[model samples]
Target: MDVIERAVSVLMHDGLVVYPTETVYGLGADAFSDEAIQKVYEAKKRPLSMPISIAVSDFEMLCAVAHVRPGMEAFIQAFLPGPVTVILPARNSVPEILTGGTGLIGIRIPSHDLALRLIERFDAPITATSANIHGLKDPQTPDECTVSRELLIDGGRLSGIPSTVVDLVERRIVRRGAEADKVEQFLSTL
Candidate 1:
């Protein structure tokens, strides 16, 4: 089977995966599975209080996990499928582990073809956190990924810049990284 098929199998079995995105490598897991979510936290040695983001394939998938508030769809369309993570109101189905009790979620729709394909094929949300130990550099290549995962889908060297985290509900940038300038420009026009 191809790597993506294998990755999907891994995910189906509650395994973790290291996959490439437009900006950096991401450690993917079944976002809705509490057990799988714990594995991701353990893999990165990340604190449970920190919370993790999630990746979706398209707008419909995104809305399934998050509340697309007023005028938020346009804001999401402006930067998503590129290198930005939009913070949104979480649906009840979203596990509390992902929200850190905040009732908010950071969602991504990666523009990278492989990442997109994997999510589409998996037909479910995957954890979108960087494929690295917490407090370490986000990996730009598979070789640079520091987290433990059952599978790794290499997409060669990435730009190394992480996705910019945005909170449209609050009208602010949470953590600026890739495409901050353009995001700011787009926000200005809003």
Candidate 2:
């Protein structure tokens, strides 16, 4: 089977997969499946209180999981399908486990082709947390991943820098990484 098809199969079975993103290799699992999401946390040794980000194929998929505000469309149009994680109010459909009980979710639409295709084929958002222990350096390649996964889609080296996390509800950056200034500038206009 093709790589994305294989990744989708793994995620469908509540299994973890390591896939490359624009920023880093991501440990992905079905975002709507609590069992799948728990496995991601276990694999990465990530704390349960720390919410995981979800990657979508496009803005529409993002809207399915989070409550995208009307005015925020401009920001999404400018920054998404690139390296920026926008946090928005969560829809009731999003599990509390994914949000760490905060009722907020961080979402991304990575520029990487393989990552986008994987989400598209899977037909839903997937967990997009880095494929390493919570405190360790983010993995850029599959070999650098410390976590065990059912499948690995190696897309060569990644940018190593993570997406800048912007909290739309608070109108501030939660964490600065790649393109923080650019994201800030875009938000400033809105």
Q: Which numbered prediction scores highest in TM-score against the true structure?
A: 1
Worst-scoring 10-residue span by lDDT in model 2: 68-77
Least well predicted 10-residue stretch by lDDT in candidate 1 = 73-82
TM-score of 2: 0.97
lDDT digits (tens) for residues 1-190 of candidate 1: 9999999999999999999999999999999999999999999999999979999999999999999988898888777788999999999999999999999999999999999999999999999999999999989888889888999998999999999898878878889999998888888877
* Residue range 37-84, candidate 2, lDDT tens digits: 989989988889999999999988988988888777788888899989
Clashes of 1: 0
lDDT of 1: 0.94
Q: Mind sharing the TM-score for model 1? A: 0.98
Residue-pair clashes, model 2: 0
Question: What clash pairs does model 1 have?
Answer: none
Clashing pairs in 2: none
